[model samples]
Target: MSVFPIRFLTLAVIAFHSNSFAASGQEQQLFLLIRQLDTLDTLVQSTPRFEAPESNARYRFDYPRLTQDIQHIRQGVKDYLSPSRAQPRDPNELVGDYRLDAAHAEPWP
Candidate 1:
């Protein structure tokens, strides 16, 4: 395989991790969490398919991890919505500190 893809990925990662891309520590963490949740959600939605079936077709899935990710993603969103660090703020204003700028928006898988 060519070394270019890996090098490009490394550079892209480095470029996005800069402070200019994220407004604050909380926003950065939210960005990462939402990105991860989106990735996991996409992966969970896609299932492997076979043109032909085998006599004993079986596949292993991590149900626990999937459930854990769902729970964590829920809490992360709640935390992101909360204005204060201790308790949640108004439910109507859920987008408390989230930056609307696309620059801070992490890519979804």
Candidate 2:
């Protein structure tokens, strides 16, 4: 009937397809990162230099450089995998109540 309905339908289809594409891309990226992590884990396990004393290597080295590398990689992975907190909020919710002098402030939007 109306052009508005057709436009709305078109937009809905585009949104659905875009969401599917984005989701698949995210899944692929996550799988690749996990694979890389698994490979790193294997290397870490195979390294005699990275071993602990009670496992038991008589006297373990502090290995500060290796520790720093591990920390940096771990932090990078954590940051990459972490969800962003800057999400859109409901516009109706007001952030500040400073303007009490007004008869009313329409909802934040």
Candidate 3:
């Protein structure tokens, strides 16, 4: 066997390995982002709840929905990272609206 073929095979293997390492680096960054998202979700859940005292504020922060959206985003990223196969895309879009109208209740007699 000629030495030239052996050298070429070695170089090809090294190049493939380097490419895989580069891909893994990108994957690692994405994984870090997912972790941050999880932390944010936890913070959102722990947020203190308070009711405005007869306030006329038009909009208030919708904490529960915001948490749900964060979960959805995390799941979407996870699915993208490890997709089982080509699947149908979700038609529903993120609401992204954290502010909602504050509900008014009739004062008890």
lDDT of each: 0.44, 0.40, 0.59
RMSD to native for every prediction? 14.5, 24.8, 18.3
Model 1: colliding residue pairs:
none
lDDT of 2 by residue, 1-105 (tens): 123322433343344335444666865555454455445444443445423234322333323333344445444445556646644333333221222212222
lDDT of 3: 0.59
Q: Write the per-residue lDDT of candidate 1 for residues 25-94, one digit (tens) a residue.
A: 6566556655655555454445342223233434223333443545554564656656456765434422
Rank ordering of all candidates by lDDT, starting from the highest: 3, 1, 2
1 or 3, greater by lDDT: 3
lDDT of 3 by residue, 41-85 (tens): 666555555545346677666666766766776777688789999
Off by over 4 Å in 1: 1-23, 49-59, 64-68, 80-85, 88-109
* Native-referenced Cα lDDT, model 2: 0.40
Colliding residue pairs in candidate 2: none
Highest lDDT: give the candidate number: 3
